[model samples]
Target: MDLTDTVAVVTGASSGIGEATAKALAREGCSVVLVARREDRLERIADEIESDRTLVIPTDVTDEDEVTAMVEETREVFGCLDILVNNAGVLRVDPVAEADMADFREQVEVNLLGAMNTTHAALPVMLESEHADIVTVSSVNARHPAKEGSAYTATKYGVNGFCRSLRKEMADEQVRVTIVMPGPVDSEMRDWENWEGRALEPTDVAESIAFAVSRPEHVEIPEITVSTTDKLR
Candidate 1:
């Protein structure tokens, strides 16, 4: 999976791990398509990366039609899609009894269905490529249930299950499906000042994804779990 000149679409590229991943891929000479709701932030990142092969599509991953357009635009501009990074996601922490149903629903919509929409749209293009990769950014919550995270965890777990099955289904194909379940990371998703324990940086997770994608075409990395050395489940 040589990243040089390969087009990699990264959702939620406006910030956090998505931003870091986009820049990392650009540095590796991968053509990057940044998809997110914020066009201004995407513009800023594009300028910072200064990659001639960068495309910014302001899209809400929860919308199937927008995702389709994103993929189409990527194809139109890049002529090929090699990697799809389903990094678009959201999180909310609240107990079921006290949680707002709207927040829970938004979590499912963005984290679960967003991945479905983006992956569904990108799969056809990836399947056509000789060597392609689909990397899903999930969370440790998918494996361990944390207090006040039932709804958020449900979406993460749902993606984990879907990707696990898809990985097996595509085992014989050229397309590789890999899941990345990360622990607490220093990103916009959490407050760094209020945190008491260790947290992995966004680039830490980004580098791991890059490593997985850089592996040989004959190898398929099913899953990679990353967290700070001092941070335990």
Candidate 2:
């Protein structure tokens, strides 16, 4: 799983952990494909990397066509895909009893269906590589749910289940699948006023992804849970 010369497709690359992971992968000598709806932000990240090896694909993962195009475009530019990072997600916090159904549907679209769409499209390309890795960014809430976070929890749990099933299917192919669960992160998704001093930084989760991708081919770290030392919920 040496990242050098590898091609990684990262979703939600415009911000948060995906952004950091893209930069980290670039630093490790891996060619990166940045996918998100924000072309301008993707361009900014591409410019920061300053590498001709990067590809920016403005994609909304919820769309099947866009997800397929993302993988096709990555293969077109990089010639192969070695890694797929399913980091695109959305969070809506409200009790099911009082929550708007539309909000829940939106979360499911981006968080669960989005991961499925991208992973399904990326699998064939990954199978063509010598070694491949699928890293999914889940949440601690998937395992330990909170009262008001039902929809978000359901989507993360869906991601966890999807990754596990995908890993079993790829077991014979030697394609590694890893799930990372972070408690909370101070990112664009969070409100700074309420976050205060709590929560892990997006870079912390990004580093964990880097570590997983840098491991030996024989080593498959399936799941890693990370949280701020003080924020034990």
Candidate 3:
């Protein structure tokens, strides 16, 4: 809760974990910038923020130009960005042989490239800040792949790999990187599946994300894995 007045950008903030994380950040007194493709949803969420310091910028993180402009505009409004939450993602489930190329490509574009694009743009601003953090929303599937999860698994794996490498790259800088892997969160992404068991709520993962970044400046949590205990998956 030591983040009062700090600036944070949360992608995929229109719904699910991203939306929850934005609210959690705001509750911790962070000035949040909501980034996603849905302006109506973003505006609705922004209205609920108590700080009156939220910026809703409709963005497709898969596009580098949009991400670039997003960061630039965030700097213009907030002067600097202290935290970046790379939570924009999509899910595609099927065996590799049965996979549609379009679905696979879409997954990669949003889950993998979107995080990369946002991180690419935010790193420069983060480095200049007195203290900064980058928290990526991966999945437990990134480490434990499931059946019928070829494309989705691949993107989460890429997320895991990318964040690990970036953490090392930013180790010497004030900026720190953390990869958050959660399993079966109760969100639209999981609802698409015929998943019937209990699932972690979006707020669960959001709080985990908040805890990761709330650590003292001298302590950096590199990875966090949150999953349901009784899901019996």
lDDT string, candidate 1, 25-73, tens digits: 9988899999999999999999999978999999999999999999999
Best by lDDT: 3
Per residue, candidate 3 scores C-alpha lDDT tens digits across 57-93 of: 9999999999999999999999999999999998878
Scored by CA lDDT, what does every candidate get?
0.90, 0.89, 0.91
> RMSD to native for every prediction?
1.6, 1.6, 1.4
lDDT of 2 by residue, 1-233 (tens): 55789999999999999999999999999999999999999999999999999999999999999899889988988899998999998877776899999999999999999999998999988999999999999998888876688888899999999999988998899689999998778887763233344788888999999999889988999999988877544
**Model 3 TM-score, all chains together:** 0.96
Per-residue lDDT for 63 in model 1? 90
Name the regions of candidate 2 deviating beyond 4 angstroms: 191-197
Which ten-residue region of model 1 has the weakest summed lDDT?
188-197
TM-score of 1: 0.96
Clashing pairs in 1: none
Q: Model 3: which residue pairs collide? A: none
lDDT of 2: 0.89
Clashes of each: 0, 0, 0
